[model samples]
Target: MERWVGKVAIVTGASAGIGAAVVEALAKQGLIVAGFARRKERVEELAKKLQGAKGKLYAVKVDVSKEKEVIEGFNWVKKNLGPVHILINNAGIIRNNTLIDGNSQQWEEVLVTNVFGLCVVTREAIKSMKENNVDGHIIHINSRSGHRVPNIPNINVYPASKHAVTALAETLRHEITRNNLKIKITSISPGYTETEIIEAAGLPKNNYKDIPAIKAEDVAEGVLYALGTPPHVQVGEVTLFAVGDKS
Candidate 1:
């Protein structure tokens, strides 16, 4: 397989967790990476970690959920790294609450970050890519909850947001096809993963263990595999569930 020797890629939420892992994976393959996140210090540390890798990594701070910031971040990447050849809309926030307990804040935060952020980033990327006439590839990191019930109560907003990702990815693929653009878009849905997101949710580390929950690296590997395919071949959708997950 041909490696991303001179390709430019952008990963949102690269400050940590799955986004960080995705940055590292692409960097090892020699893709110039623009790591976008709101956390300056952590994103800088991630860039430093990738410094020893084959590819060059640049960190930018932006709140992806905000349209202005998203536009600015992508513009910065274009100015500094050239047009993006690949994009991973990996920035996401998860909030758990039942209908009764879930206030508007919890619902709004998850929806805005997961859904609106993805849209904002992708819109900017498509605009830049079209301007540059670059045939780009997009990978969306969705979740298993988007497909089936996890048998857990509450967490309605998180699942709802992920479901929207799944739907949006599929719809975007067709739009690309209709436009006759040489672009590929795919979505990878992961089951419970061991990441800071889960930790922040107050779940025990690796607690989704009826089947061993996947690691951030596992999802990252999935993205790498999708991107590594031949340009003519597109891996449309991948749903990765835990080993023992009935859903």
Candidate 2:
């Protein structure tokens, strides 16, 4: 943590949930944290609350699904804040529809936001890190669905997008290692987190209430642990689940 003080970090989907929690945690550790989200006002409100913290928080309007917005956001960070030292790819979405009867638009939305968005951000962040010679860390806020499909219904293409993320993490890791770049990549998968994403997916309230769930801050703690590790140590993947969660 001490090593990262006064450094720069970017957290996507930072208006709420896991992304918000990660932003707060990193900022408290004295890093210049940038919170990127479509709902820029929410991040601005959060930044106000974080006043007098160990580090500063900057709220940037960015829809990760948009390539132009992503590029501009990174450019702003580089010109204003400095090169990026850490990137937490936490932005994602879900739709409650089955494949056989699912709306293609819903599936596309899920894929664009959860998969393509992550890739764009990673590419831009890596460019900054490599150009500036920063041995940074990249974390994907993946889901248990990335590893295995839950028994729940109507998850649609959400799980498939996550599985792509799972593979992307490894693919990026190999690419970085082969290039002799010191950048580290990790995939943190959490099972059934208590976040708005579930509700937004249109799951019944009773469904999630009956299941074991982890808090967003718990997942943030995992990110902290990963970032706090020695430079030589790279946590490849971390899967988190509530104690009683069967899946």
lDDT of 2: 0.94
lDDT of 1 by residue, 1-247 (tens): 2546778898999988999999888888888988898886887887777788888888888888889888888879878889888999999986656677667987888899999999989888888888889888999988887786576655667887888998999899888989998888999999877788866665444335465677899999899889889889999888776677664
- Residue 135 displacement (Å), model 2: 0.5
**CA lDDT, every model vs. true structure:** 0.84, 0.94
What lDDT does candidate 2 reach at residue 146?
99
List, in order, the clash count of every candidate structure.
0, 0
What TM-score does structure 2 among the candidates reach? 0.98
Put down candidate 2 lDDT per residue, 43-131, tens digits, no spaces. Answer: 99999999989998999999999999999999999989999999999999988888998799999999999999999999999999999
Off-target runs (Cα >4 Å) in candidate 2 are none
Clashes of 1: 0
**RMSD of each candidate?**
1.7, 0.8
Q: What TM-score, computed on C-alpha atoms, does each candidate reach?
A: 0.94, 0.98
